[model samples]
Target: MKKAIGLFLLTINILLMSCANANQIKKGDMLFKITFAQGFSNDTLSLCLNSCRIVYNRILSSDNTSDGITDLQISVFKKNDSFSAKIFQGKEISCQADIRETIKIEIVLNGSSQSFTIDTKQGAYLSIEKNGNDLSLRQTKEQVLYD
Candidate 1:
């Protein structure tokens, strides 16, 4: 029993220390750079479509908009780097592209926002929902929809 109690206390201490090391984010700034492959200069989706894809990263904004992000934009391709990317249209829609992109998302819960980083480019999906006075962030390969 003594050993069990010691283990539990150690676990809690480790978690607290890790959380303290996380970055404190606000509405704007703190950009995460993503690199995608490109082919030509004329510009065509087909060039990268076969090799790369896009994913939506939704994070809660301090602006209080329902969508969280107010003015969201990403430049996947750079003339110098030859990195190309595309953002899906409409609400909660994505290209279903396959790549290894990691981005953090924030969700509003209990009148506040909590951030979570996910790798949608690596075929990852996330669902945030309220579960009895608490919030849950689930990451899986399955589709997650919100009302």
Candidate 2:
């Protein structure tokens, strides 16, 4: 009977240890991706995109955002990289002539803004969102929304 009880206790201890380990997240690590428009004119648009990428790196490195992670794991891809802007029917509109050529950026966390360029060009834009429950709260300094 004592041997059986000892085996049961050991099983429980192992299960508890596994559960505890699962709750911990590594520091300075992130999974994200950024894609840019293609066939850029080596001009402002490209510049902006490059600037945005730099800003993105800064944002990712910030402990104020990443919960104290030092290294970032981001996957980047460039699609067709060709898009067109037009003034049609007295209205300004944009279209992707090479629909395959476009930009896409995604990150693990959703909140705050990030900047990046068109690739090697100096154009920039901000990425912002209010993350709900999908984001962990331990690393945040302000009140987060959960829904």
Off by over 4 Å in 1: 1-100, 144-147
TM-score of each: 0.29, 0.21
Best by TM-score: 1
1-147: candidate 2 lDDT, tens digit per residue = 999999999999999999998854332221122222121121121112222322222322322332332222223223234322211122222233332213333332223333322221222222232223222212222222322
lDDT score of residue 25 within candidate 1: 26
In model 2, the runs with Cα more than 4 Å from the true position are 27-147
Candidate 1 residue-wise lDDT, 1-147, digit = tens = 999999999999999988885632231221222221111122111112223333323432323434432233332322222233334333222233432355544434334545556655443344443434344555555444322
In terms of lDDT, model 2 sits at 0.30
Steric collisions counted per model = 3, 27
CA displacement after TM-score superposition, residue 77 of candidate 1 (Å): 13
